[model samples]
Target: MTTSPILVTGGTGTLGGHVVPLLRSCGHDVRILTRHPSTDGVDHVAGDLLTGEGVEAAVAGAATVLHLAGGPKRDDEATRTLVRAASRAGVRHLVYISVVGADRVPLAWMRTKLESERAVAESGIPWTALRAAQFHDLALTMVEKMAKLPVFPVPGGLRLQPVDSREVAARLAELTLGAPSGLVPDLVGPHLYDLAALARPYLRHSGRRRPMLPVRIPGKAGRAYRVGANLSPVGAGAEVGKRTWEEFLAERLG
Candidate 1:
């Protein structure tokens, strides 16, 4: 079925950089809604989700709205803005990319994502929210920052399932092209490892050998990580992603 022009938020972001191309490659007419006017070549409309600027024009006549923009500070308002605009424009489906265990994770950032999920559900637009594990690049970035110190310090017993952003983008593209299924199964990495273990490959690849020390993190956030609240233990929709953390690190750091 041919889709109406698809409007994508965060088109230049980590996930959007992949999702937009996949959509276009599949022959969907993709347009980006961004603060800046430029989309690096793809058609784009300037908009700001926080202030509701240029959003209605962006959402106008869109069959599906793939919402991938948001930060801790702006996620709630941004999602609300997009939902209202999409509902008004009669968008058929809205696809959102969110983090896994957002509701359970004790962080302000996670709370914002959870709030955004709720807003999307209540928006009255046919919508699907896909929760994904940490992107491998982000995990590697954390390691990159920690390696700068003489010794690498990480929260004790914290675990992560780092999925590839490209894989996550592929799943989002599949959902955006299909019907809206609320709160779909999570997309997680093939392997689960502790923070230190996750960082080891990066450490070895960069030839930076420092003692990876585990330090106890205080408060509820730390406890959440220690308990693996962020993990998708049962493979809700696992085995779909074949890229391993080591492979991602090799490509990134090596």
Candidate 2:
């Protein structure tokens, strides 16, 4: 009997870059649903999850779908589009990667993520969703921009638990290959750090010095962040990734 390929969205991205190889190494035939045509001759299907362009065809014949494609905007709409297509195609398992605090954080992006989670859960298809912390790469990007300024406005009361993307990919791959499970425990880094703690190390590594100006992130969002709404609850049985921010910096910048 021939096995259907596992269709992965955002397979060219950082998390997907790790996941696709992992799935392939485990002897699973993998396919990538991409917006652009493949120039590398891999098993890529041209499709757009937002517009539904070529999405139906891309979902065809694939028993499982790993949905990792998302952005700052229109993520809910895109997920709905994909859900409709996947449902029509009788996809058995749909795996999604989301951020921590999708339900608790009162932000536009978090709203979209929560909506996307609802779409998957209500789609009548077997599904799994994993909420993870911000990746070390994203943390690095944030600190990099802040270190470049003569005076960086450090948002007071803001903290993050940045996990390793590869660890996240490994977990997602496990969930993708297993039977459909509901919402799993959150995944976060080993420790939490304030924005200054994240940025100070970057400054030292890059041979630059900057004045840190502590600034409050006013309004409801600020209030949410001040209370650690973005972090996974302690003793809630959430999984922790092993890599630390310093280790990431040493490997990336050194």
Candidate 3:
């Protein structure tokens, strides 16, 4: 049987970088949607999700689409553009990468993600949405951003399961090859850690000595995190990622 090409939007980003290579290694044809029209290996199609430009051609011959493109600023119009384009292209399967607690999280970014997931489900295409915990790199980035401050004021007692980006990408590649199962298991790291604890190693690596002030954030989002809304349920069949926060810090800091 001829393996159908899988078009991965945001293919140059962290998760898509890992996902595209995995699909290629699995002998599936992989195509990447990028803003640049460069002719690199693994079919590259130039497209812009914001204006819905070049999307139809990007997904023309693909059977599966890993919809990973979204603005960090949470542009709902951009998301609807992509969804409409994907539907018009008649894409068979869509595998969306979402964050944990997106449905109930009070943040605007989380709410935009929830809206995008809903658009995919109602797009008349078989779809699978994989909600994963925050990426370990994102936590490291936060530490780097806050390193210069004398005191790190973090919301205390909030739980986070920071999974590796590579692990999430692997699962996405697998889903591209398998049948669509509406919403798959939430992927998380093997261990759960508090935000302050996760930032300590990062601080040490940067040679910064700062007191961590555990502050209670005043918001519904803070309450949700305190209740472990960012964790996978016991029966969710979550894939356990091997990389730990310590390991990630060691590699990144070294």
Candidate 4:
């Protein structure tokens, strides 16, 4: 007997790109909804979550829904739209991907994720929200962007335990297959490092030399970052991933 497909929003995106195949490899049919359907191996549905176009159709008859569409813009509103569509379609489980310290961090993106989490919880659907640390892919991208500059500017007192995107994807897949259990513990990186230390390896790998300048981002947000709102606490019910930042850069830059 075949099971219903797992519907994934942002299926073409970073974490979703890793997750789609893993879910398929587990013997489940995966349906990915995107505004513009691509020629990927999975079933692509043309849909837009923000405008509620094709959302119901995309979610229809799916056993599970993985909502991983994250950005500074349209995240919270898209989540709300998805929750409503999932509820209407009677989806068995709705899994949300969120930032680790979304609730505590003063950053706009984190706040948006926090709001999205609340939408899922209040949707009255069987739902699970799994918050994860910064993806190493993102970290690499940030470092790559900074490498272009003559001098690398590091955020003062900001430390991140950047976990691999694939690890986060694996965790999301597990939750998507299992029962919805509200909020799960954060999936964090194995170790933590400050910005300068994190940037050094990237520079070395790319054969770039620059002075690491520590810059304070003035305001309440900066203060929150300095206080470690983004870093998972010790024994905070964290699921530590194996891939370190160094390993990530070595693999990519080697």
Q: Which candidate is the best by lDDT?
A: 2
Q: What is the C-alpha lDDT of each candidate?
A: 0.88, 0.93, 0.82, 0.89
Model 2 stretches astray by more than 4 angstroms:
none
- Write down the TM-score of every candidate: 0.95, 0.98, 0.92, 0.97
lDDT of 4 by residue, 109-167 (tens): 78889999999999989999898999999898888898788889999988999999999
Query: Candidate 4: TM-score?
Result: 0.97
Question: lDDT by residue for model 2 over 83-114, one digit each (tens)?
Answer: 99999999999999999999998999999999
Better of 2 and 4 by TM-score: 2
Residue 221 lDDT in candidate 1:
88
Model 2 lowest lDDT segment of ten: 34-43
Q: What is the lDDT of residue 98 in candidate 4?
A: 90
> Candidates sorted by TM-score, descending order?
2, 4, 1, 3
Query: After best superposition, candidate 1 residue 211: deviation in angstroms?
Result: 1.5
Which portions of model 3 show Cα errors greater than 4 Å? Answer: 1-3
Q: Compute the lDDT of residue 249 as modeled in candidate 1.
A: 81
- Judging by TM-score, tell me the better candidate of 1 and 4: 4
Q: Which lDDT tens digits does candidate 1 get at residues 113-198?
A: 99999999998888999999999889887888888999888788688888999999999999999999999888898888887888
Predicted candidate 3 versus true structure: per-residue lDDT over 1-254, tens digit per residue: 24678888888888887887888887788888889756667788888888778888888877888888767765456667777777888888988888888887688888888888888888899999889898988888877877667888788768778888888888888887899899887889878888788888887887888888878967787787777766776776887889998998899789
